[model samples]
Target: MYTYIARQAIFDRNKHVHAYELLFRDGESNCYPAHITPDEATSRLLTNSHLSQGLEDITQGKPAFINFFQDTLLHRFPTFLAPEKIVVELLEDLDVNEQLLDACKQIKQNGYRLALDDYDFDLKWQVILPYVDIIKINVSMFSQQEITERTPALKNMPIKLVAEKVETYEQFQFCLELGYDYFQGYFFTYPEVIRNKSLPSSKLNLLELINVSSAKELDFNYLNSIFERDVTLTYRLLRFINDPLLNKSNQITSLKHALTFMGELEIKKFIALLALANLSDNKPGELLKLCLIRAKFCELVSAAKREYNNPPMGFLAGLLSMLDSLLDQPMSVLVNKLPISDELKMALSGEPGNLFNYLQLVRALERAQWQLVTDYAKLLQLDELLVFQLHHQALLWGNHIHLASQSK
Candidate 1:
């Protein structure tokens, strides 16, 4: 059986990733199987994925919030996992009783951090509050008045409050102002488009660099000139190429050599990375990381299938998909300015096609929309396991590139 797992990032107040909530699916249904008990689902997750592959590889060393049914908790399944590596989240549907309370206390005593998932303000749950380190509130489910009235009390306590299912930047700001310690949502993926805003010269320059780099035939002279014009971009590109993790045997010394060495495809990606990093100056780092993951994932999928006549175009499409979010402009406007192929422009502009389906697959995996993932995979004729593996590889590659770009 294939163990399909997707992670949703949990962000701190500053929007830095704090942890990830691991969502598991046994099949294309993208949710728990009807016949499998929650306990069995959790068991299979721990045994097949967490144990076989290890949580560190899955979570990048950050703690994972794994859900536990009352029976799973009572069976001490959490103790088998590393305490430092996971936060045991108790499902809200579980009945609060002596046995549950005792299990909570025991898990707490064993050095496990406990979180209350989808917490509603109920007096019955108060008895177990002492053991809870985090409380997740589905912000979508509560009225503003209800949230204001309920959150203040939780704020006064030692526990951290997490606003779940936040869908827009406005809601994120509201939750931040309301003293939410952590946020869980896809809000960051959206563009906070401000009308009448003009792109500054510096940003326009970056866009030009991206456009030039993305051409069917690379303009080596123009690319080298662009790099030479900005010392920081040149330094970043060189440092990235020379990153010990890249396992380069010889040092890359000059702009010309670097441009020629990386060839057309890699040079385009490097320029895109540098330009996007600069473009995302004030944005969340996770947004940039997501773009990289999408770019690589789309490229890998297209390459594996050998469907797209221009395979590298998938990479370009994925990278530019989030340009709207990074620039705070509509994708339609951005695509108009970019001198890309019609298919790429269409894909980025939300037109449906094979490329669009590739992007949808990445988004579905990110959000743990399993059924949609299956549907997209089928449309693209991709194996579910291959999709999962590609996504994992993309995550690792994206994380590495993001970290490398940040390094001095």
Candidate 2:
């Protein structure tokens, strides 16, 4: 009895992550079970996932857009979740009658944001439109001209428009121009390659630091020199070592002492974090946050198995997974310069292996591809519930790291 859940990020007009739509599945079937009513699916999700482990753990403090059928709304299931933390999404197929309309009014009065999912602008929905806060439109269902014509009416209303199933940069730009308040899709994961864009020397040095730190053996003198040369790196390293979450008994005053305390594993992770924060300066912060989540999630999964020859490589592989998007270079080229192990290189290069399976499992969970998530989890010999729990832990850890980086 594993509780299956996955979230898809929603980005604002500026491409920053705004919220996540939490998708719930009853089983490895990857969708709502045909036998169970939508009402039952929402109930189980609330009881098993939301009630047991607060929503903040899974959503990293972002508001979750969760679907609700007419019955669930009338039953006040939305009341179980925190109003500020969730947006009650009314399914498009819901009957728009007096009872449902009264329920919608009460829900709005209760302080919960309301979203109309897969809205098609029918006159029947107009009766309840005044109570809605957001309207989600499936961009794939309409032509650009149709969208342009249909959207102007929404623009004048207080409601926000969310462009759903947006799959490419061009689509995002068009929607942006059309005044879409938010977007939902995989467009941000694709790299926007700028031809002949050279890596800055400072970033190259950071890459060198990442390469050196990930080595099989620590080069203490070499690492010390690199830290000594860059004051910002030294400051961040010390600050990371002293983060209250790490729980240091005594404050470390020197770089050598900090390295010694962290040993090889923590030092490697720190360097990776430093490089990630520095490299992703110009990109959306969500990319860095995703990398941290993947890194921590992969590390936790491999460490749980206890059968892999080297589990630390799992973290490195996950951390480097987004180098192509961050550096605007192909993964093959980036892996060549990193000096990581062949196994890690193979995994990051999309070749099949234990680490590759781990990366795939994280990705599948991220994209709500439950069958692929089940397949990769089976290949890795991990329990489904454990994977979900580990993903929750990773989200919390990533949120902490993301906040720490921002504060500095």
Instruction: Assess every candidate by TM-score.
Output: 0.96, 0.93
Q: Which stretches of model 2 miss by more than 4 angstroms?
A: 27-35, 51-53, 307-311
Against the unseen true structure, what C-alpha lDDT does each candidate score? 0.86, 0.85
| Local distance difference test, candidate 2 | 0.85
Per-residue lDDT for 1-408 in model 1, tens only? Answer: 677878888999998889999988886456777778878887876787744456777677899998888788888889988899999998889999999999999999999999999998878889999999999999999998899888989999999999999889988999999999999998888777655679998898899888986788878777767767678888888888888777368688975776666666777778888888889888888899899999999999989988554328889888888998898888888899988889989899899988898999999998888889988988998888899999989988998888888877
Distance from true location, Cα of 206 in model 2, Å: 1.6
Model 2, span 119-235: residue lDDT tens: 987899988989999999999999999999989989999989999999877889899999999999877777777346688888888898888767888787888777777898888
- Scored by lDDT, the top model is 1
N/CA/C clash count, model 1: 0
Q: Specify the poorest-scoring 10-residue window by lDDT in model 2.
A: 306-315
